[model samples]
Target chain A: MADIRSKIADIYSLEQLSLKKSWVHDRHPLVKLASTFLFIILVVSFDRYELARLAPFIFYPVILMALSETPWPIVLKRFALTLPFCLFAGISNVIFERKTAFILMGLNISVGVVSLFSIVFRAFLCVTAVLLLIAVTPMSRITAQLRRLHLPDIFVTLFEMLYRYIAVLLGEASTMYTAYMLRSTEFKGLQMRHMGSFAGQLLIRSYDRAERVYNAMKCRGYDSFAARGKKKRLSAADYLYLAATCLPLIALRIIDVRAAYSIVF
Target chain B: MIEIKNISVTYPDGTSAISDISLAIGDGESAALIGANGAGKTTLLLSIVGVLPAERGLISVDGIELGKKSLSEVRRRVGMVFQDPDDQLFMPLIYDDVAFGPRNLGLSEEAVEKRVDAALSSLGIAHLRDRSSLRLSGGEKRIAAIATVLAMEPTMMIFDEPTAFLDPKARRNLINLLRRLPHGKLIATHDLSFAEEVCPRAILLKNGRIFADGRTGELIRDDRLMDECGVEALR
Candidate 1:
């Protein structure tokens, strides 16, 4: 129960990081958002065996993390959570496509091995880019940018509410787990037999809570229209940041820096 | 003034929460709605904000009737602070939550900021303007929730169980804060001492019906009435 509560607390740790003042955090949210999206698209667009080319993309997250003063352990912890799924997704690649791509130190490296590494690296870069974006920009600014981009009001509202509701759902689950543990002695964890009812109760409680929250929003004049905050004009630094980040990503996507490196050397 | 004329509210399952409840809270008057658990205090508050429609009868806020057309106006006039501060403070930041109502009202960004700043400073939580509602202490969250309502510039305020989860000092702080607010207030709570301290009048409810409505001092001292309503009398 304590672990669950702490994990819920950790969910907002990035938002806390975003509150810090730094050059990376001060850039316009739209540019930060655009740059992150551009980085992900470029990183994912690489050929399955292009691990060498995908290597330099690591600088984006690392540089941003350093500039923004975001702690590495927090990002690494969240990044670690995505590792198993990425590995699971690419594991099959290691088994199939066994054609030898190249020879490493003493053995032949299979195409499958190269592709698996590519998948893991791509996952790392994409995940870290997103984490950095969220770590630098507040959720409200992101949602506001989404609204400015002409996204549907309901979609943006849900996007914002869903982020908050995750905490609420986890909170309800944590409380119920504590209650269950208190009542049922000699149980290491929730008994499998009680799992069904526990989940049912959680669902009922969360549903009731969501209804109350909706009513509260309605009382405050929430009528499906997303509330508008002050619009920020992108300063010269914002444009410079956008060009500095995105232009390279576009350049990398168009040019094979790995091939060019071999020629130059 | 806020008036409810013979209002009846029933749940979807036909559970009659409040039956023909009639009451009026005049402008600038603070009243306590005292009741036991399951005594329809929340139902009454919900109906006044037009969240739950009354099966019959009328609720009007400052001469404007609460109906489909007047709901926006009525909501503007009567700000309700829910029992759980979490329910009311949903925005990511306290400033955003406080600015939510005025922004929805189509106020200019500058005007919204002014209202939010005024509300936060009035509640003495100006330092928490940038903090997330999730990170606030219980007392701070309660006050921040009230600020969300205050930014709307309502003539009347409704609070449901305002002191549900506060420490002694926080409760005292809330009591003092409530006593100082100039808006007419209809606070639904079972805390007799709290009611006696903050309100001049008290309306006691028993099983969805009005059992007694009188001065807070006289009602809190009515041992029989307190006993009948299952609420502890102030000794």
Candidate 2:
């Protein structure tokens, strides 16, 4: 129950931060969205052995965080939630491919070790770029941008409703869990026998709630077609931000900065 | 004006929620639909806006019958407030929720903004325009929900259990707010005091039928009808 409450708090905290007014936050959502998408693609395009190349990508999130005035701890907390899968994949690479790639001082650096580091670094940069986009851009703006891009109205509305209702579903589940726990004694978790019924009940409740929500939307003149607010045009500063973000990432993808640094050494 | 003729709504399992009910509310008239749980207050309220499909009846708003072609137009003129504010408020922010109806109506951005502002200020919640809907207290959510409907500039407003889960102060404030609004209202509430204060007419429902319909003053004093509808008998 406490965990779910904190989860809700975490989501709201990010939402609160996105509401702050800053140069980065003020950039047109479409521009920020495109830049972040390009950033992820560039980060993941690197060769598996290019660990040093990904290090410079850290500057993107760092600069954006500094400009947006969003603290590091909040972004890192969300990043930590995504770390386990990357860690598992990287560890597998370390275990399988152990051929030595280089010799430094008295040590041999294996191919697997280099790839592992590169994988972890790529994960860090990619996740950070996505998080930075959300941390700076309000979700409503992003969905509006999606609609402007001619995405299917049904898909966009689904995306919006899913994001909006997640907190409500969590709250409902938490209340049900609390009620069940109160009726039981010394139970560390829900009994396996009760899991089926408990989950089924939650599903039924969610379905009923969705019906009511749809009716509410229908009552407000919402037809099956989606309607978005007026589009916000990109200002001169937004274009500058876009150029600053995309140009260097594309340049790094074309030229291996890591190999260049190694040659200098 | 709103009119219902011989309407009956049945569930898929063959249980009738609204059974052969007919009523009407003329221009600028307020009416209270009072009933106990399962007496079909919500079912009937939903039917007014063409949300619920009536198996055997016709509902017309301003002489436009409720059907596929007229549903959207009817919805634009008849705004409904659901029982749960969370359900009604699906947007991330209050401003968006309030602007939703007007935007759907194809209003210009400037007009939508103006209407949203007017609605929020009328509800005394202009300061909460940017606040997230999920974080609002119960009363604030209720007020925000009303604002969302009011922004549509509907000719008539329908609320299902408007005072559910409200504190005394919030309830009083809501009743006062409803009294001041110019649009006609058909409110379904168990709060007889709220009905007395805002609505001049009252309709009592029992077993999916209208048990009694009369002036609010005359109806509340009818001990037999009050008892039949499962509401408290006036002292």
Candidate 3:
């Protein structure tokens, strides 16, 4: 239960980081959002064997992290959480595709190996781009930008609520787990037989809590329309930030920096 | 003034939560709704703001009867601070949560900002304007929850277990703050000592019915009534 509580705290620490003052943190949310979206698309559009093309994309996360004063360890820790799934999706390539793509150090390098590295590299860039976006921009600002973009109210509201209530749901689960552990003599965690009832109880508790939360929201005049504050117009700096980050990504996607380097050298 | 006359509320499953409960709280009056667990304190509060519909009878806030049509107006007039601050402070930032009601009231952003500032400053939490409610201390969260309602500029305030998770100092701070506020208040709490300190009048509920209603001093002294209602008298 304590572990769960700490994890919940850790989740909010990212939002805390977003509150810090820095150049990247101060960028308009729409510009930051657009740049991140463009970065992801460019990174993901690369061919499986073009790992070198993705190398320059590292500059995005590195530069943004430095500018925003976001700590690398926290971002890396969250990135690690997504590593396993990326590996799982790409692992099969090593076994199935064994064709030699090149020779390095008198040894054959398989296309499969290159592709797997490319997949992982792409995943890193995309994930880090997203993490950087969120680390610099508060969730409220992001959701507000989404609303400004004319996204469906239900979808945007769900997105915002889901992010906020995840902590609430985990807190509920932690409390119930603590109560369960207190009652049972054995300390090997919950038994399989009790798992069903435990989950059902958690669901019921969550439902009750959700209903109360909704009532509270309604009392405060929370209609489906989210209350947005004054809309901020994009400044020249915002456009500069967007152009500086995104134009290079687009140029890189079209120019093939690695091929150009080989020819020039 | 807030008034409830013969109002009875039941769950959708047909279980009676509160029945034939009638009470009136006048302008600038601070009253404590004292009751045991499941004594319908929460249900009655919900019905007052029309969050929970009454099966029968009438509830009015300042001569405006509560119904589907008057709900928004009633809610605007009566600011309800929920028992759990987490439930009340749902926005990402305290400023946004505080601004929520005013924005819904169709106030200009400038007006909303003023209301938020005024509310936060009134609670002495102006520094927490940009802070996330999730990261606030228990006491701070409670105060922030109150600010969310205060920004609405309501005529009356309702608190459900305002001191449930507070330390002694925080509880004392809350009591002082409540006493200083000029709005009419209906506080549902089990803290008899707290009730005695902040409220001049007390209404006791048992089995969803009005057990007693009188001055706080007389009711807290009635050991018989206190015991019957499953609430301990202040030692």
Candidate 4:
């Protein structure tokens, strides 16, 4: 039913990144983003076979996610969406590989099983890191950070338009579905023949709203030249937090000399 | 020092939103364009502000042609307030929204701060300065919306339906609020009583053209013009 499909979309938006909470919530988005990226880069830098070493790094983001009060189920559901890549890269690593029996808990497991398991684990961590970065840091701040990092204005604008409109569009769709529900019984909503036209109407309405928003933005003099930055004078506390988190990470980066373990064996 | 020479706007669907609309307001005068809904009141304002970019018109703000070369200059001079306060007050807090315009024009922090405070105080919404714009009452939001534009210190102010959804008291308060503003303003509305009260001059916009322009009371007193333009005289 359209209701179910729409709820699914709402669920996607409701994860750690619902705009209602994300707009006013108190998570240090930039800090969480930095940590997420750092974890990914650190994990990727490890050899595929260095599962034992990578195990320790998992605690950092896991603890951060938990402490941040992010909804882990949504995070995991989003993480699940990345399985195709895992299936392709990971299962390929399994199916086309040489199988030599290895002992695990006194039972012999194939070499294919070991590599596949490692690939899935690696994929899971990668997906989770991406999800948490988005979840903790509302897309708006992330877009702002991208702008700060000199990303093209077009993509930044695109990101902004997408983030702002996804909620608005979902709301529009919900209204449409509600109207249908009130008018009909059973799965009488989204009649197969009318789905195309209904979706077309929804798109037109969303696009029209976007244009109106842009018009409204201009009327209120919303040129980019108006952006304000807090003279966020790095207080001693801010510096301390940055140093406490960043220095060790930089030191670790420098010390990651050989990556110690090799998967090419 | 604003001019509109033979402006006509037709939507892509081949409907004339506004046709042959030509009017001008002097430096120290307030003008109200009154018309019923769907009569191109907003479209005319949008044309003046260069938002819609009239298909055939020459709009000059303070005599600088509104084109690519002087867009920022012209836009900098013209401040606009939309119908809904929510659309205009896009910033998190009122101070930020009020400061938005001045900051964009690259005013110094001290200067912008001064403008923000002065504007908010002028609108008597200074106490709402630190509050989230979303949390403000509708009237407060509208005042903050106006304050955002007021802080810019523009040559002319345009209000697109300033009293679309306000109760009587709030509407009266806003009318009083507008009456107190010392700058030139153009209010587009269908509320004839509001027009007669807040504006000295009224322009009747019908099918996108200024069908009549005269003193507010005299203009509204013409029951034929009011009916023709779809504006009912409340008084």
Candidate 5:
């Protein structure tokens, strides 16, 4: 039991959304998937000042995550690692340099800074959406669902193959590293000419390995350029999820948040 | 049965791997493809499995002509166990790796489970059902890789260097396991002993074609053909 738990933990970002003792691991992956995607759309459609309106949307993912019984610590850790990208984009608001009039407590502030913050906020939501999506849905199922959702098959295929195949290639790389370490007494720096040759050799070797891998896959009767696995279906909850979130985003977009903000200003 | 007629293979990088070679294997028959390193054994194996496109030859599995259209069907029948167990076992767990073949066949859940169990038990790795294939030992992984395809129930099996590096005992054990399986096998190897044990017929490979053909016992005894084809006599 402990072995399986550790194995599952190793597979997922459980610290951010750690599984509880009674958590059902078999819930629809589509639930988390749909909510995350819809949240991305809603977050991206916010008005420049409607930034505060986006705060509530964060809870949607957090709530689904909590209900799904994913480990908060693990999920939070994943979110923390991802925070930097949004922060970097958000900081651009600080350097927007454009001066525009905005009232905060009867004082004027730069709207460029606000717009920049909006961009940052949008990025944060986007990143969080992706992290939550993956946290709930293992990458394998996510790629399959992407294929089912009419996402460009090639891009989705690239992601699926890389994720599935890298484990074996990384094993080979580590073995090479082990052999190199065992043979050499004192290998100081990896910047030498011989090291370049070694790296180049590794590249060629991995390519050969990939050729072998394609052959092996072929021999197993695998022709699905996508992937082979039992896919989690799009359930009713998932459909309702798309409706609950996307409906609002589309409606607000139609209502024109920019026009709404203009009237308020 | 797999039949290759007038086949030629050149890699996209402009190097010919195999050229204008023809051969046939009957149902339930085992044949050994002997070759030195770079003698195109792997390419020939891939051509049978439709991984490598033959420049000029007709290859068929189970009586269907193999080209771009029939390639997938050809692949479905001819199971090729690769040289490296690492590349072959891609799934995380033993069961999933074994199930990969049947799952591609689009079998139902119950059917896939039954096939997975049967393959694992037949390979004598049923105890390894939940274990990580990547963490398994070399011998264990080799068996697991074979079982991965066995789950598909392919009648024709191709193994490229089934036992390249192994302790004497594990190599012997693997040979024994192969002997017990009922599937027709095409093993390409420099190990004359393993070839003799697994297959009685031999095709000596040189310069991308079969240089000599004879019974394994006869060919292994023929020092002239053995030396000429670069197949060293096993002492």
Candidate 6:
């Protein structure tokens, strides 16, 4: 239960970082959102064997971390959470393909080894781009941008509600789990036999909570089409930031700095 | 003024919560709706906002009937503070929650900012404007919930179990705050002492009917009526 509580606290640490009044955080959310999307697309478009070319993309995360003043440990901790699936896929490639690609440390390295490294690198780049975006842009701002994009209200509202209540629901579930653990002395966790009632109770509680929330919303004159907070237009600096981010990403994808450097050296 | 005429509400499952209840609250008046658990206090309060459809009756606020067309306008005029502050304060930050109602009402940015600031400062929670709702203490959450509704500038206010989980100091503070508000207030509570302290008029509901209605002091002092209503005498 304490672990659940701490995890809930950790979920908001990035959001806390987003609140800081820095240049990156102060830029328009739509610009940040579009630039991040472009960066991820560019990073993922690399060829499977383009590990050397993908190396320069590390500058994006490094520069973003320095500019935003977000701690490296926090970003890396979250980045670690995305590694398992990439590791599994990479390991499979290493097992299936063994054709030699290069020699290093007096030993031949297989094409599979290179591809595995490429996959892991690509995953890291893509995850870092997204993490930096969210680390600097608040969720409300993101939703506001979604509204500006003419997305359907149901989708936007559902996203907002899910983000807001997920922690509360998780807290309720953890408290119930603690009570259950205290009751049965012999069991380590909730047993399969009691799963029916355990899950049913949570469902009923959530349903009742949803109804009460709807009533509260209705009492506040929230018709389905009620006006939301209008977002301000992007300033000249915001456009400059967007161009600075997107143009470099596009250039990096088209002309690999690694290829250019190797020929010059 | 608020008026309910023979309004009865029945759940879809055929359980009748309120049966032919008639009541009226004059302008600038405060009333306590006293009832035991499952005695329809919440249903009655919800009905006032047109949230729960009444099976048969008419509810009017200052001669404007509550129907499909007037519900939006009526809701704007009547603010409700729900039993659980968690349910009412859904926005990520306290400022947004306080601004939610006014924003929905299509207020301009300057006006919304003014109302939110005034509401928070009035509740003495101006310091919590940027804090998330999940991080607030129970008392702070309750105060923030009230500020959310107050920002809408409602003429009347309704509270459902406002002091359900407050500590003694917090309860006293809330009661004091309630005393200073000038709007017509209808507080549905099981707290007998609370009713006597804040309300001059009281209506007792039993089994979906009004069992008693009179001055709060006289009604709560009557041991026989208090016993019959299943509420404890003043403590």
Report the number of the highest-DockQ candidate. 6
Encode model 1's per-residue lDDT on B116-187: one tens digit a residue. 999999999999998877778899999999999999999999999999999999999999999999999999
Q: Give the TM-score of each candidate.
A: 0.90, 0.91, 0.88, 0.72, 0.79, 0.91
Model 3 agreement with the true structure over B1-235: per-residue lDDT tens digits: 9999999999989889999998899999999999999999999999999888998999999999988878889999999999999888776578878987888787786898999999999999999998877568899999999999999999999999899999999999999999999999999998888999999999999989999999998998898989999988766
Rank by TM-score (best first): 6, 2, 1, 3, 5, 4
Candidate 4 or 6, higher lDDT? 6
TM-score of chain A of 2: 0.91
DockQ of 2: 0.59
- Quality class of the docking in candidate 5, CAPRI style: acceptable
> What value does DockQ give for candidate 4?
0.26
DockQ of every candidate structure:
0.53, 0.59, 0.55, 0.26, 0.36, 0.61
Identify the runs in model 6 with alpha carbons over 4 angstroms from their true place: A1-3, A263-265, B62-64, B108-110
Higher-TM-score candidate among 4 and 5? 5
Candidate 1's residue-wise lDDT over A48-149, tens digit each? 999988887888888888899989999889989999998998899989989999998979999999999999899989998888889998786788788888
* Residue pairs with backbone atoms closer than 3 Å in model 2 (clashes): none
> Which runs of model 4 end up more than 4 angstroms from their true locations?
A1-39, A47-51, A58-145, A178-194, A220-247, A250-265, B91-99, B107-140
- Candidate 2 stretches with Cα past 4 Å from truth are A1-3, A103-108, A228-238, A259-265, B106-111
The candidate 4 chain B region of ten consecutive residues with least summed lDDT is B86-95
Error of 4 at A45 (Å): 3.8
- Could you tell which candidate, 1 or 2, scores higher by DockQ? 2
Writing each residue's lDDT as its tens digit, candidate 4 over A208-259 gives: 7778767766655555423322222435544454455556655655564336
The lDDT for every candidate, in the order shown, is: 0.89, 0.86, 0.88, 0.72, 0.73, 0.86
At residue A61, candidate 4 shows an lDDT of: 53
Per-residue lDDT of model 5, residues B128-177, tens digit only: 98777646778898899889888888878999999977778879989999
After superposition on all C-alphas, the RMSD of every candidate to the true structure, in Å, is 2.8, 2.7, 3.0, 6.2, 5.8, 2.6
A best-first ranking of the candidates according to their lDDT comes to 1, 3, 2, 6, 5, 4
By DockQ rank, best first, the candidates go 6, 2, 3, 1, 5, 4
